[model samples]
Target: MKKKTTADIIENNKISDGIYSLRLKTELSNGILPGQFIGVYTENSSRILPRPISICEADEDKKELRVVYRVSGKGTGDIAAMKAGDKVHILGILGNGYDLECLKDKKNIVIMAGGIGIPPMLGLAKEIAKEFGGDNDKQISAVLGYRNSDTFLMKEFEKYCKVYVATDDGSLGYSGNVIDAMREHKLTPDIIFACGPLPMLRGVKSCAQVADIPAYISLEERMACGVGACLGCVCKTVKKDAHSNVNNARICTDGPVFLAAEVDI
Candidate 1:
């Protein structure tokens, strides 16, 4: 039942190849947590649906929201054209974010992310670090993946967590994927949080199951309606949904983030 609002664009600049950093000033930052996303309505009338992008950071005090996204197609291309001082219509504070309940009584944590899925983890780590209250005993490590040496947000994450990188071309930290980097690093954690492509998430789920570590993951589904009403982004679940009596869940509402064991992956 949320209404769309026009927000002022503070900055819109390309940070890396095919990627952009968009900053917006809006009070809708309230109720938005790490792992939640917003739907940005593009200027083109032909592209009616708003493009949903995971929030990179949200500052309640500044009333600012940071979104880092890839210029994937025409819709996103339109978004890239937007500039500072422009007005954009966005609807959100959407999706149930990463559940912090699984973090209680846990100390060591590992965050796994690949490609554009890496943005949400930055916000997640920031919150985790805050919740830990500067307790140095708590170690938060980020295992990230990239196609090559051109990595984004490396400095921001390095500020909060120990960063390890994996590149497909052997152009960076680890030569293989995130899973290989994790094994090589021999990371032992009490809990995990991940966001990435399906294959990458499947790997993380398997790792969590075999190690008996609690893990939560966000599904990067291509969505039409950013709300559950569309049913365009349902994912398979282990249990039947109470409303539909089917073993499925809408990624938009039920979660873009869920316990590793809760969904089939």
Candidate 2:
């Protein structure tokens, strides 16, 4: 269920260049899932549309949710100016998250994330570890991709699973993209979950198809209304909907998470 509430900014800190981690104390954090997102209202009155950010970590005990976002435009810039103790309107635990039930039987799980896409994978790693007993018992591997070395959340991922990094400029772990790192390291997994740019997701999809591994991908799209009423964030799918009789799916409502084979992208 989604709720519209005012959440207090518990902490808003910059973790790296152009990237920030924002933590909010809200009741909505209780039921948030790994690949779900929250719609945050920014200070820009000129733009009424809320910016949708993926949930990084949800602490039900603390009643808080964390989101790591990049400062891309006016809306996000306005959000970055907010400080601790500040309150903002948030509507969430939105979107369909990853289906972990489908992955329970799969022993080897590979989580691939790129840039800002890395945050959601953190919660996923922790969930997988907790499910299987502990980090040591699970074959969970996190393959992360970044432009350079000044990356955030690497250490956090290390706490839950084996971490492999790939940087574009060779300033970090592996010298190429994450798929290259995985290929070179020969880390084959029974299933894969990925969230990143379209190109990266496409590449991961191709690799997973060739390897015959089940894969899920979280997509990011421009949304005016986070609910289904707007029809603003639709993407072409491989299969048509039974009721709507269309081959398009909404990123905000129908998903943010979809099977790589189902989506056209």
Best model per TM-score: 1
For each candidate in turn, the TM-score is: 0.97, 0.97
lDDT of each: 0.90, 0.89
Q: Any idea what lDDT model 1 has? A: 0.90
**How well does candidate 1 match the true structure, expressed as C-alpha RMSD?**
1.1
Worst 10 residues of 1 by lDDT: 129-138
Clashing pairs in 2: none
Per residue, candidate 2 scores C-alpha lDDT tens digits across 1-265 of 7778899999999999999999999999786679999999986789788899999999999999999999999999999999999999998878998878987678788999999899988988888777774644358899999999999999999988889999999998999899999888899888999999889999988998998888999998788899877778988998785546799888998889999988988
In candidate 2, stretches whose alpha carbon ends up further than 4 angstroms from where it belongs are 133-137
Per-residue C-alpha lDDT of model 1 across residues 28-101, encoded as one tens digit per residue: 88767899999999989999999989999999999999999999999899999999999999998788898776
State residue 85's C-alpha deviation in candidate 1, in Å. 0.8
Q: 43 in model 2: Cα distance from truth in Å? A: 2.2
